[model samples]
Each structure stands twice: as structure tokens, then as C-alpha cells.
Target: MGRNTRKRRSPLATKVVAGAAALAVGGGGLVWANFYASAHESDSSHHRTRSAGAQVATIQCPDVGQKLRNVPRGARPGVDKELARLDEQITEAYARLASTRQAQSGDSAYVQNAILGPLKSKRTAALDRIGINIRRGGGDAPGGLDRFAECRGMGADQPGNGDGDGDNGNGNGGQDQDNGQGQDGGQDGGGQDDGQNQGDNGNGAAGPFADDFVDINDVQPNSRDLENGLAANGDGGSTGSFTAVCGVNENNLFNSDNLIVAPGVDNGAHHTHDYVGNQNNNAFSSDDDLAGADTSCQNQGDKSTYYWPVLRLQDGTQEFDANDLGGGAEGNVGKILKATEAEIKFVGNQQSDVVAMPKFLRIITGDAKAFTNGVANANSSFSCTGFEDRQVTDKYVLCPEGSQVVRTSNFQSCWDGQNIDSANHRDHVAFVQQDGSCANGFQAIPQLQVRLVYDVPAPTVENGQVQNPYAVDGFPEQLHKPITDHNDFINVMDENLMNEVVDCINGGEDCQ
Candidate 1:
């Protein structure tokens, strides 16, 4: 199948829901009253009578890739292509949902009939193709794949909240202004608002509404405890670290393709990403291509690839990709912020001597679809420079003056020993257990930790709206939720460099 390079259609007229009242606060601050009502309420009496209890916020479909654990090697390429098609289908369906708010408010069944129904049909055909590919690869096809085709409309309060999932139940229910005293003891500003009722500023073309941010001061100190057995102190484990001095993508290596997840498919990520290290990385780059690629790292031996979604300030700046499929068209707009500092480090395991990571080993730390897939695989950490100890998983932190925004991704440290990559791109690597030991028979490998710092203007939140808000690039339906932030890495290190990394970790020394 060829790549889907079609540009998204221009957004429709702004849709504003009824019952939202504009209120003036003290000091001329303007706030929208009942901001959350637009998430579900409608103005049409006939529609209200027909579906008074429905509050569909976003579409929720089961993840097909996560369930295909036994795909044969011969079928991987076909399955991956079909999976990317599935994502495209969802993106198109969500766009239709966002563009038809008026029609949805007039008839509850319109969404079911017009959007989700067609999506399911497309997914069913794709699923059947996947089964056929598996069978052709000399493997038994998994049964009941069509069961994953059906998708449903989810409300703001449901398990998979419309725009994205939050840490707790803090869906798009409006901001909790009680000094951050909300569920889960952490304030996430009620996730991302779908811009159902706000004007041009609340346009759904690019999201990350005012409710997606919470003042860092309002957030309670919730630092996580360190992993056990990290202290070297003559411990019988690898205690050293290897730091790779990769430039912060100064070469302007950017793309919308995700080689680890959707190889051979373009626009697989549906969002722009900043890349460092390996220079020859794209949807079609093979192991040989990466091995011979130029490196952005200060050391030529480290040809590993590291990438993550770009962060953008929603200040209406027309970037280079403003009109492209993965940029403005996919709801990832604004000025792309370059990381002031990008730190990539490899550290030893706490409980055992780390082994060399296999060449071409691929690892994806966080879940890019965590907004809809839930936080079980979400590992993103958003914090401030001075307050790095305090991190939030689902909310954008409003840093104080002179404090820069920080994003940290700690990749899995245990390897399953046999596969360099897995069907889900995760089964090959696993995080250490609570006791700092690799579970099952997995072997400990050097853990990759990436830290990125951005100096951005603090967003202004007045009334119930935000100005100059910044958010990570994400899927159109995700609304740029912080929980969806993720990182990707592919190890293409030469054999000598891989050995040096293992030796340095075991020798209790830090080397660059």
C-alpha cells in the first residue's frame, strides 16, 4: 500500500455550544461560565429529548497492535501497514466528528450512523487482511480480530475520556480551582477541552485548552521514590553510567514518521518529532541504512537514534509545516520549540551487571496514544527546572518565572534476550520490578534516560481560557494531552561501542 499523503480538509466554521455565559471577573478578567457543558449538552430541544443522557466526547476503539503478540515475522510488514491504516481511519473519523458538532447536537444518532459505523467497516476489512497475511506467513491467524473493529463514542467522564485519558477521573469536567485539591491528589486541569463551544480561540483545529494546565504551585509535592538498590556502595551490580553527547537536533532532523511502530508507512505518527543521533531515520530506513547513517552525537561510535514529539507554543505562528498533514492539518500547530538542552544517558541496572543492548534494538518508552489507551503504559514526566522533584504525568506544568519546562523519559531496562524488537514494540524490553530485579528471565540492560528542557513563555490563564499555551504534538483526537507525550529510541551502536558501554557500566565509571 502507498502512503496516505492526503492533506486534511480545512476546518469547518467554529462551533459554539449554547448555555455558555461570559462572565467578567475582578480586575477585568473574563471567564467563560459552564465551560464543561459544551462537552455534552446541546441547544436543540428535539435532540435533547431524543438523547438526554448521552455525552459523547470522543471515539474509543480497541488497540489492535497491542493484542497481536504472535504475528509471524513474514507478516509483520503487512500487519504494520494495515495498523497504520487503522490509525488513519480513526484520525479521519475524529475529524468528521469534530467538524459535525452542529449535526451531532441536532441528532444523537448522526455520529453512530455517519462516523463510527463507517470506521468499523473499514477496520473490519483491514483486520481481515491482517488475518490473511498471517495465514500466508505460515502462521495460524488469530481469531475474533473483527471484534476489535467496533468503536464507541465515549463521554468526558468515561474510562477513555473523549480527548484523552487523565491520571485520575479528571476528564474534561472543567477546572478544579480549589488549589489543586482534586482526585488522585494531583490537579491535571481536567484534561484537554474539545473546543465545542468556544470561539476562534477555542477552535478545535489545535487543542490543549486552558483546562489542560495547572499552576505548578497548586500541585502538591508528589515526588516518586527512587528505585531500590541503586546505590553502588560496593554493591554487586553495575553502577556506572554512559552519557552520549548528542546535539539537540541542531541538524533540524524532523519527521512525522515512526520507524519503530509503523515501519514502511508515512505519517504514521500523525505528529512532528525532533530527532537526534542517527541521521538516516524515516519510515523506510532499514538496519543497514541506520548503521551507515551519520550521527549527531559528539562521539561517532554512538549511532543510536533518539526522538520524541516536538513541543509547540500555540501562538498562531505559521511554522514550516503549518499546512502539512502532520502539522496544522492534524491539529499540531504553532511555533515549534527547540529543546534548549537534550540529555541522553545510559545507566546501569540496580540489581545486576548490565549487558550490551543488541544492535537494532528498538524501544518506545511512553505511550503516544495514552490519551485514549489509558495510563498503564504512560511514562512521561512533565516538570519544571527548579522543581524537577515534582512531576505530573497528565498535566502541563505552569512553571514559575525563570523556570524552564522539563520533560523526562526513562526507558525500560530489562531485555527479553531473544528479540531486538517485538510485535508491540514493547515486549522485547521490560521495566524492572519493585525490588529492582528483572522479572521472569529477562536480562538487565543499560537504561536509556532522556531529559529535554525548553524555555517557553508562561501561558496566561484568565477566566477559563488560556493564551500562548504550549503542548506536545499529538494525534488529532488526543487534543495534545500531556499524558500522550512519548519517546522513541533505536540502538544502532557499533559492536565496539556497545561493548564499551557495557564495560563502563560494570566498571562503576561514567564515560562519554
Candidate 2:
């Protein structure tokens, strides 16, 4: 996308309350405590924590989509449309909340009356429609969906109050060591000293407060254990890898539609995504359309669709979508940054041989609503190129000069063998068990691992003020938290190419 010339107004000053303590562990590791309420918990404590003059950071609502595990195939289209509408409602409410800091500081109930109440009514209407759609499609309508209609304003101090799952407790903060940190140097480490006020970007609507960033140096080197019995080459498992040569979106295919979650609906994602591989991808694309369309991959036989939220630099550079619904208008303003390198690879399982992924099998690896939905499914990982040994899930990694930022997503590797899609879009696939074996008769499939590298200018965090920040585009209410980063994929490889991938991996031969 090209840059636009429109300049954003200076961001307004925002005051936030920090209630969590900073723990100092051995080896100089720092563990930041979480203060927000979990989304799955009741809101009684959340209400008790609210008071006049408290800063309402974002809105948190129950993830309605995750609850509908059995909508009939015929009803999914209509239900998906309504779900998309619910997202739009949240975005609208967040916009209003961001703009009304003055009123919020004065009247404690103002947010409840002006923003959340209206949002609840709209969500209730959409929920009603969803139930009707399921019934019309020859399925039993789920009840109590109305309980998910009411959203609450989350403050900064209420631990787990719609921020995340409060799992960043260990000093390591759930980081991975592989594919991390590049050896480079430039600029001072970015992050505010403990007890220092965080910087405000002034634009509350499009957030990523200064506190959202952390210096790579202060993070402890804590890496998670391998999943699915994965180990070194001596384990006697599928050890080969297959790489897909899809350039880093050089073709510049961009859209806000999500075919897997909200087919036939425009602006379903409410955020722009950089699309590679399949050239014909959008809300309305069908299997037939995709099969006939061109692709960006070097091997045309692999026409799988791969996409993820585009990262943007908040440098007041208006992008081509500046005035569009999914762009600046939805609080996702900034200069979009293309990935410097995109590595798409498929590997084999540790316990057994792998099977080919079903054609048109759709998979989503991370939670898009993680900011408000909790971190039960949060899978995005971030680190500096040279410091790959240290990764953090919630805070954006402030890469030092010369070093680049890295994002890695490892998709689920087990499938049920029958369905290509599930009612909730997750039941059809699963991650391997702790023993590295597929559970419940599920078969192991080639695991897809995507590593995206970006040469992002490290954001400056000083005296609680952030000058320019880079964040992934997401729903307005999400506030561009790094934990919300996710990836999407649809397997459309022709049988020949799919078989070649399986054989290449099973034979323990790296191929491209």
C-alpha cells in the first residue's frame, strides 16, 4: 500500500494506574505482575475495582465465537456475518471510549451508560440473529448467548481484568529460544525504569501505550520446552523440513476479510492483513476460485493461502487505507510495514510419520481477541533477531539498533482426519499432547512453522513517553498488544504437491 499525506493530530495525554508489583528473581530476571481480570472470570471484582477518576484502558467482552461450537454448516454464513457485526460494535465502542477520557475521569458510570450500554444492546440484537440463523439452518439454537452481550470497561489495575490470563508470572514470560535474537547493535535499550511513568503516544484510539514495550536486555532467558516429543535428530522421528518460497508479499496483496471465520463479509478482520501464496483471497473466495487463481509461491502446485495482520509504524505516515473502514477510521492508523523475510516451512511430527493436510483445511494459530478473551489460546511470540533466546508474549520487544524484530507462529500439528472445518473452527485440529503423541485418535499432520522477520526501528520509551511505536493491526478494542498477533492458513495444495511434502518430510530430506 502507498503512503497518504494526511497527518494525525497530536495524541492526548493519558494517565494510567499501575498496581502490579515488580519481582526481582535470581540472575537479574524481572517478572512483571499482572493486574487485569481474566475474561473467563465473573466481573464482580472488576466492578468493585472501578471508581471515579480510574482510567478505563479497554473494553472486554466474552468471545461469542468461541462459544458456538456446533452451528450447522448452512447457518455458519449468516452466523459468521453476525459475529463480524459484533466485532464492529466493539470497535465503535472502543473509538468512543478512547475519545472520551475527559468524561470518564469525571463520571464513573459514564462508560457504562454511554458506551457499554449501547454496545450491549447492539450485541444482544446480533446474538438474537445468530440464534435465529442456527435454528433456520436445521440446528438447535444455543441459549444464554445474551449473557455474552454485555461488555465491561477494563481498567489497568484490575489484575487479569480482560488484559490477559496473568500467566506471565515466571521471570521468563513464556519466550522461546529458537529463531531468536540476531547479533547486531544500535541505540540504547528501550524501556522505562521500574516505578517510572510510562510514555503516552497521545492517540488513545490507536494505542500501544509506552508500557507495552520492554527492553530486550531486562528479559530473562526463559524458553519453553518442546512440544509433541520434539527433540534433536537422534529421536528417530520425521526430521525433515519443506520450505515454501513465497516472497514476503512483494505483490502487496492486502485486505481485511477473513474467509475462514467470516466468509462473504467485508472488513471481517477489522485490520489489514498481508497476504502471500494464494493470489485470489478475500471474504468471498471459494475453493474453485482459489484453485484457478495464480499464486506467489515459487511452486505453483502449492496454492495454499497464508496471511496475518500487517504491522504498522506509528510515524504519522498515512497509508493507502488511511480513510477506509479497516484503516485509520477504525483506529488502525500508521505506515504499514512489509515483512523483511517470511519463512514458511512444514515439518514432521516427533512421535510418528505425518499425513498430508486435507485440501482446503483451514487453521488459525493464535487468538485474535486475546487482549480481552484471555491467553488460553495466545500463541504469538516476539523477540529481537539476535536475542532469539529470549521471547515474550505480551510486550512488544524493543529491538536495539541494527537488530530486527521477529515473530514466530507454530500451527497445530494434529487433525481429526474427518472434518476440514469445525463449528468453532478449532475442534478439527489440535496441538500434540505432552507426550508428543496425537490424542483421541487424531492423526499427526505436517506441522507448519512460520517465522516473520521485520527490520523495525526500535521505539523510544523515555520518561513514560513513547515517540513512535510499531504494532500489529487488530480490532480497535485490542489496543495492538503483541499477544494478539496471529496467523491464518488454508491448505489448498494440489494432491501431487501435498504428497511430495509428506514424502519429503517423512524421508528426512529437506526440500523446497
TM-score list, all predictions: 0.84, 0.82
Candidate 1 global TM-score: 0.84
lDDT of 2: 0.70
Model 1 lDDT per residue over 162-246, tens place: 3222222111122222111124211123332344343124323334656667778766665433342221122557888889999
The per-prediction tally of clashing pairs is 3, 25
Q: How big is the positional error of residue 164 in model 1, measured in Å on the Cα after superposition?
A: 13
Q: Could you give candidate 2's per-residue lDDT for residues 85-172 as a string of tens digits?
A: 7877776676666555556656768889988898899899999999999999999988787988888876432223433222211011
Best by the lDDT measure: 1
Report the C-alpha displacement of residue 59, candidate 1, in angstroms: 1.5
Q: Can you tell me which runs of candidate 1 are displaced by over 4 Å?
A: 1-54, 156-158, 161-206, 225-236
TM-score of 2: 0.82
Ten residues in a row with the worst lDDT in model 2? 12-21
